[model samples]
Target: MKIIKFGGSSLTDAISYHRVKDILLREKEDKVLVLSAMQGITKKLQKAIRTALKDEDEVECIIKEITKKHQIVATQAIRDTEILSDILERIEKKMKRLERLLYGINYTEEVTAKSRDMILSFGERLSVHIMEGIFRAEGIKSRAMEADEIGIITDGEFGNATADLKHTRKNLKKTIGQELDRGVIPVVTGFFGQSKDGYTTLFGFGGSDYTAGIIAYSLDSNVVEVWKDVDGFMSADPKLVSQAHFIDRLSYAEAAELAYFGAKILHPRIVQPLEPKGIPIVIKNAYNPDRTGTVIEKEGYQREDVIKSVAYTRDIGVIKIEGVGVGCKPGVLSFMASTVSEHGINIKSVITAQTSINFIVDMEDLEECYKLLRKKHSSAVEEVVKMEDEALIGIVGEGMSVTRGLAARVFSAIAEEHVNVDMISYGASKVAFYLIVKGKYIERAVKAIHKEFFKV
Candidate 1:
């Protein structure tokens, strides 16, 4: 069995949907297809939710546009007139439900975490509905299923939740397994799942990939194919370095480190479930399926290159805490960690000295992170500093773990460019080395390292 996932761009319109159908039909193995929402739908829903929180009626216009967009895709893609009509009816019903939710939020003038997740989930829900209709119209027996319906239960962390692996695995085998056995292709929604209490919970940004991971693990599928618009994972962002090349293979750890450090091709969480099982993940181009995309598995490809890719993220901020007693205090670091966790702010990386500490976190969480630290840890922190407009550049490869002088080579390349390093950390797995620099230097740093390591 195979579990396949298509990104938003792969199903943006009628043409894309038809292409996905063709790809699935050609697959010889029994497969489960997972889909993200059409491009721009999730953003529109998020905007509608924000407008409702402001006690405005703007959600109607957003919902109308969303419904119309889906109708256009469904009508154009599904050839059978009767099937098209049925799909439109179902689409309308879903829209009405969304409208009611929006109206309730506007009337209450509040947007709780659970409500927000439910609002965002419509993207995947609506997309799969259209796709399933298209599949059925083409005489491919298929059923649309939501992630929650497949036994994907999570904890109550509304915005980003963790799956109860043992329970989820057992239930999915029963639910999805039954459908596959009956010769039906199950088209499942990608992102949000229900909590144990049945509240909709997200897996945070790029949650759709997480959805694919959980399903792949539960079924013990042969491979998880992630269909995207790109050719495959590259040695660097092509836009940054025109010389950047595609990498054909990577170990699970290398892929995860690159994703966490800012590779856009796959979400970091995708490897969470599949890694332990040693299942291979193929990142392929839906548009160019004949090309061999990147493959990530347990055993990495043996290559002469020690550095596989240079990844970078600009959405980063640094928090610096320092005092004579800062590092000496037993719980100083632990207190800072607890405070950030309490606020749901994730610290991406950290750098420490005898008298000071620097933390890297998502730029979106900067204000909350700074505020919480100041509010709670004022006594231990003599000085607090926030650095904005910085980027973390990472070089990832399993070969680096056994190779020496890799760090010196990385530092030399950056130094040659005169870019200042703000903070740095090597992954405990030795698969990656990430260093912070001014945001303006990202393109330069990435190109410099890619050219130095890969081209050599």
Candidate 2:
């Protein structure tokens, strides 16, 4: 069995819908398909929800656009969209409820997390309907399954919610195969998940990827195809370096390293559950489905290059808490480390000196970390201590440790490029290495590394 997921851009319009049809025809085998909202719909829905809270008049305007976009796509994809009247009727009812919610928000003048979720949930809800409509009209047996129907449930944390995978897996296993056995392609709504309380919630960044991974894991499929705009994971950020190369294959650890340092290729959290199954994920281009974009699986797999990808994260800061005389003291080091973790701040990397320890964190949480350290270990530091906000550049690859001078090669390139390095970290694992540099130098740094490696 296979689970295919198409990103927003791949399902945005009639043309993209046809591309999907072609891809599906090629599969011609038992499969489950998942879909994200049409391109721009999610953002537009959120904006409308926000606008509705401030003024009741905008909901109609927003709903009109939503209806038209889907209608156009449906009309073009389906031979006889006359049957769309019933579908449109159902959608209209949902829109009417949305407009009424506008007045509700207007009177309250307060948009809570739950309210925002309830609004964004419309994106997937509507997309799945249009997709299933087009598929059915085209004589393809298909059915739409909303998040709640498949037990894609989460806590009522509102804006960002984590899925209860154990429950979701059981529910999906029972339902997905039955639909396939009945000759219906089960199209799942991506992103929103029902809460334990039945409220809607999201998984924040990379919500769509999370949805696909969850669906794939549940089915234990051979491959979870993530169809996207680009080819796959690139050697560098294309926006920064024009000559970046696409990595054909990478290990789960490689993808995680790149994602953590801001590769923008895959969600970092996608690895935890899916990779354990050894279910190789193929990232393919929706526009050019024939081309093999990239494959992510276990280590020691064959690959084209020693380096999988070079990625960077901007707007990062490093924080350091120095224990001048407590370096060898086991309990003291534990105290300082526990202090930062207790504040719910992630430690990107920790470098310990004879008397000091420096760690990296997201820039947004720098202040909280600063205050947390000051409160818990203020007396430990004898000299000045602080956090530094900087851009982080990472060179990720499998078997990088084998390339003796890989680290020096990167540092030397940065040096020749006149980019000042702020801090660096790497472990014995040697698959990846990260460096901190000024945000302004990102473009030049990425270009320099790309040219040195890819000659682009």
Candidate 3:
């Protein structure tokens, strides 16, 4: 059996839903479907949450708009009017529940983590309901199931909860088995899971992929196919480097590195559960189903390609702590790390010299990191330098670690383009090489490096 996952883009509207139904109907293999919230639904939910927190009256309007859009999709996609009515009725009940939740938040004047999670879950709930109706109307045996119904229990981390797999596997096998035995396609909602205490929790932003991976591992399925907007993984962002092309295959490690650095094709954590089980992941285009997409496997493509892809991220900020004895001060680095950890800010990359330590972080966390440093460690640090508008460029491949002069060639390529790298790091796993550069020079740097290795 195979586990198939559809992203938000694949279920954006009635047209996209029709395309997805056709895609699934064409496949003959016994498969289970995983689905994300429809495109724009999650964002709309979030907007309503924000408005509710401020006690704004506009929250009701947003909620109505969201319900109207979903109602339209169901009406247009499902040909049977009775099925559409049933879906709309169910959606109305769910929307009322959401309104009540938002009203509670407005009355309390606070949006707690638990409340926020509950609000976000409506996206998947409504999406699965509509899709299940569409599938049944199209003469396919299908049923909608929540993540909790399949026993995807997670920790109480609210926004980015981690799954308890041992418990999850035990419960999932039984429930999913029962569905399969009944000859019904179980359509599971992605992203949110129930905690042990019954509170709603999400895996993260693009967590639906992670959800699919977990389900795949639990079921011990042969493969997990992720349907998205694009064909597959690309050598570079085509918007940044027009010459970038699709890569046919990648190792689990290479794919993780690319996603972590800025490849938007897959979420970084999606490969964690699949890697240990040696499960292969295939990325395909939902619109153009016939196109061959990228595949990620345990035994990666046995090719001599030293560099599989180049990925880059802009809006990185650098913090430099420099003092006469800062590097030698044993507790300085430890203190910095602990303080940052306390604030839940992740340091993307760190570079150290004889007298200074540089912490690279996302721009969203830059201000808080700086504020914390100034408040706690002003005395230990002599000078704190802030560098904004920086970008991180990463080159990923399994061969880079074993290959010699790859670093030299990469630097040569960037230097030829007159790009100055602020700091560099070779990932400990040897799957990727990352460098920090000015944001303004990121496009030129990526294009130059792509041309150097790919010669495109």
Candidate 4:
């Protein structure tokens, strides 16, 4: 059996829905289908939540728009009048519930972490019904199952919850196993799961990929197939370097690094659950299924180039703490790190020196980190600097640690572009190294590095 997941881009409109149906019909193995919301629907739902706190009328308008969008897709995708009507009715019921939830937020003038997660979950919840209805219209036995209903329990962390694997595995095997035995395809909702206390909890944005991984791990499937609009992982972003070509395969570590450093094709945490089971992830294009996409496994082929991809992200900032002996002081770094983490700010990388320590974090969290550090250790700290316009560029491949001259080549490429490197972090991970540069030079630096490694 295989676990197949369709991203939002693959299920955008009526034509896209039909394409997904055809893809599933061609699959021969007993499978479970995991789906994300239609393209742009989640964003609209997020907008509705925010609008709920300010303008109730605008929230209602957005709700209507969301309903109309799904209704149109349902009408076009399901040929049987009965299936179409049933799907439409289900959509209406979900919309009414969504409206009520948003109104609750409006009346209270607050959007707590719990309510926000509930608001975000409506996207996947709605899409699964449409997909299940389409499959049924084609005479395929299918059931629309939400993650919670199928017993996907999480740690209850609200915005970014982790699944309780032992409990989830036992529950999924019992619940979904019965459905599989009956030859029924369980079209499950992705992206969010129910907490221990029965609250809706999400796995962070673009977490549907993580959801697919969790389901694959729980069921002990042979492979996890992620169907998206792109062909596969590339040497670089095609928009940045038009010559960026497809990467046929990658190691689990290399793929995880690329995803974390802004690959965007897969979620950063998707590899975690699957790693324990040694499950391979195949990224295939839903629109062009005939093309072989990138495959990520435990051990990948060694490329002569010594670099698989140049991944870059502009959403980074550095917080530097300066003192006489900041690095030498044992509790200084720990104190600062714990303080920032307590407020839910994630520090991506930490570099230190005798006199200073630097913490790389998300750009949105830079100001808060600065204020937190300043307020806690004002007397002991000399200066707290926040560099918000920094971009992180990473060169990822399994052979990087053993290879020689690769760093020279990368630095030479950046030098050729006349881009100054603000800081560098290496040797922590065998598969990847990182470079921080000014945000203005990010494009130039990425293009230069891609040209050097890929010879484009």
Candidate 5:
């Protein structure tokens, strides 16, 4: 069975919904439909939450807007006027109750994590209801499902909770199995879940993909297709590099590396389920579904290619350690690695000189990384300098290590464009090379590499 997810833009309105239905209907086999909240429902929900917390208007306006949008699609899709009207009323009432709870949260002088989770869950709640009605109206065998009903229990963390897979899989398997057997397409909610204690929980922003992957993997589905606005993970962020091309495929590790370093196209946990089960995910375009979007697999593509994608992250921390006694000490490097690791910060890159070693990490943990290492050996080391704002633009490919003079070509490309590279790193696998430079020069660096690799 295939688990198909329609992202926000794909199911934003009546027109998009109709197009999505056509796409699903065209498929011949049994499948499940996972949906994200409509394009702006989540944002409106956020605004409403704030208002409700402030004892302002109960956010009835935003709820009404959502109601109206869903109703318009229902009017076009649902042939049974009476049934559609009843369903619409049920949805509207639910929204009103959601608004009341938000106000009550304000009334109580508190918006507890548990309460906030339930409030935010309304986005997916409303979406699944509307889609279920649409499917039934069109003579499709489909049912709406609340997230909690399928056993996706998460931690009590309000904003960003991790999935409890064992429970999730057991519960979801029964529901999906029943639905598929009945030839019914179950439209499951994204972005929200419940706890072992019955409290509502969420899977964080962009966690919907995580939701879809979890479901797909647990149910042993053949594939998970993520339909998004972009065609796929591109050579670089299209907004940053206009000429960037879509990457056709990637290994799971490579995809995770990109996501870790500010790549927005894939969900961070999308691969977690696949990693253990060896499931493959296809990142396809909603706008142009047939395009060769990126396919992620457990195995690296055996076919050789010169380059894959040029990706970068501006949220980077660069620290230079310079001291007379720090040179060639047996324990000096050990101390550096151990201290940083203890802080739960991964060293993105580490470059060593005769008397210094410079390290780069994700910017958020810079202070913690610095403080831990500094307290232990700052004075003992000699001179310690930290560059807080820097970026790492990574040139990735399996062929780079084998490509003769690949390092020179990369540096030459950056030099010809007058871009400065402050540090460089290579791994034992020799699959990727990362260049650290001034954060402001990231775009310039990416453009230069893009031309060198692809434009050449």
Candidate 6:
């Protein structure tokens, strides 16, 4: 059996639904289908939640728009009147429940983590119903199963939760195993799972890919196929470097590094569960199924070019703490890092010197992080600096640590572009290394590096 997951881009409209149906029909293997919400629906749901705090009328309007969007897709995709009616009714009921939840938030003027997670879950719940209808219309035996119902119990972290795989495995083997044996495809909702306390909790955004990995690990399936709009992972973002080409293969470590640093192809956490099981992940194009997309495995095919990709992101900032004997001060770094994390901000990387410490974080969290550290350690810290316009560039491959003078080539390419490097890091992961540069020079740096290494 195989675990097949479709991203939001693959289920955007009526035509897209038909394409997904045809793809499933062609697969003869016993497979489980995992689905994200239709494109833009999750964003709209988030919008509704924010609007609920201030304006209930705008929240209602957004809910109506969501209702109309799903209704139209169901009408266009399902030919049988009965299936269409059932799906439309289910959509209406779910929307009504969502509306009530939003209004509760409006009345209270506060959004708890639990309520927020429940509100965000409507996207996947609604899409699963429509997809089930689509499959049923074509006489395919399938059931629309919510993640919670089918035993994806999480650790109860409201915003970002990890599945309790041991319990989940037992529950799934009992629930999903029987269905697979009877040849019934379990069309399960991705993204959110139920906590042990029986409340809805989400994995982070773009977490549907993580959901697919968890299911594959539990079942020990043959492979996990992720269908997206793009062909697969590329050597660089084509928009930044026009010469960027497709990467046909990548090791699991290489893929994880790429995703973590800035690659949008897969979620950073996706490789966690799959790696231990040695489950190979195939990234395929939903629109063009005939194309052989990139495959990520334990021992991936090595390229002639040692560096598989140069990935970069501008969504980063640096927080510099400078004081006399700051690095020598006991527990100062630990105190500051613990404070930031306690407030739910993630530090990407930390660089320290004799008298200074630099904390790298998401650009959006820079202000709050600086404020917190300043308030907490005013006497111990002489100055706190927030550099919000920094970009991170990462080079990922299997043999990077063993390769000779590869770092020199990378620096030479960037130096030719006359871009100044702010900070550099290495040896943390043998498969990858990253450097920081000014945001303005990121495109030039990426293009130059891609050209030098790829020689395209």
lDDT digits (tens) for residues 20-87 of candidate 3: 87888887877889999999889989889888888668778977899999999999888898888888
Error of 5 at 445 (Å): 1.0
What are the per-residue Cα lDDT tens digits for candidate 1 across 341-360?
Answer: 88778888778888888888
Task: List TM-scores for all candidates, in order.
Answer: 0.97, 0.84, 0.95, 0.96, 0.80, 0.97
* Model 1 CA deviation exceeding 4 Å by range: none
What TM-score should be assigned to candidate 1?
0.97
lDDT score for candidate 2 against the true structure = 0.77
Clash count, one per candidate: 0, 0, 0, 0, 0, 0
Lowest lDDT sum, 10 consecutive residues, model 5, at 300-309
Sliding window of 10 residues with minimal summed lDDT for model 6: 298-307
Better candidate by TM-score, 1 or 3: 1
Model 6: lDDT equals: 0.90
**Per-residue lDDT of 288-344 in model 4, one digit per residue for the tens?**
999999999988767889898999999899999999988887788888899998887
**RMSD of candidates 1 onward, in order:** 1.4, 3.9, 1.8, 1.5, 4.8, 1.4
Across residues 1-456, which tens digit of lDDT does each residue of candidate 6 receive? 789999898988999988988888888998989999999998998888899999978887988899999999999998889989999999999999999999999999999999999999888998888888988888987888899898999999988899898899898888888889888888889998999999999998888998898899888899999999899999999998888989888898999899989998898788888888899999999979999999999786556678889999999999999998888789889989999988878899998888899999988889999999888874678999999889999998888888888889999999999999999898898889999999999999999888988997
Worst-scoring 10-residue span by lDDT in model 2: 299-308
lDDT of each: 0.87, 0.77, 0.87, 0.91, 0.77, 0.90
Say which prediction, candidate 4 or candidate 5, comes out ahead on lDDT: 4
Query: In candidate 2, what are the lDDT values of residues 1-456, reduced to their tens digit?
Result: 888888787877887877887788799668888888888988898788778777677767887888788777777766655757656766777777766766677789887777777777777787787777777877888888888777886765665677788888888888877888799989888887888887778876467777878877887888888888889998888787766767787888888888888976677767766876888788888877789888888764423446666788875777766656655656766776788876556677776777877767778778887777776674667543565647888887777776677777778887898998877777645678888888888888877776766667
Selected candidate, larger lDDT, 1 vs 2: 1
Candidate 6 TM-score to native: 0.97
Model 2's TM-score against the true structure: 0.84
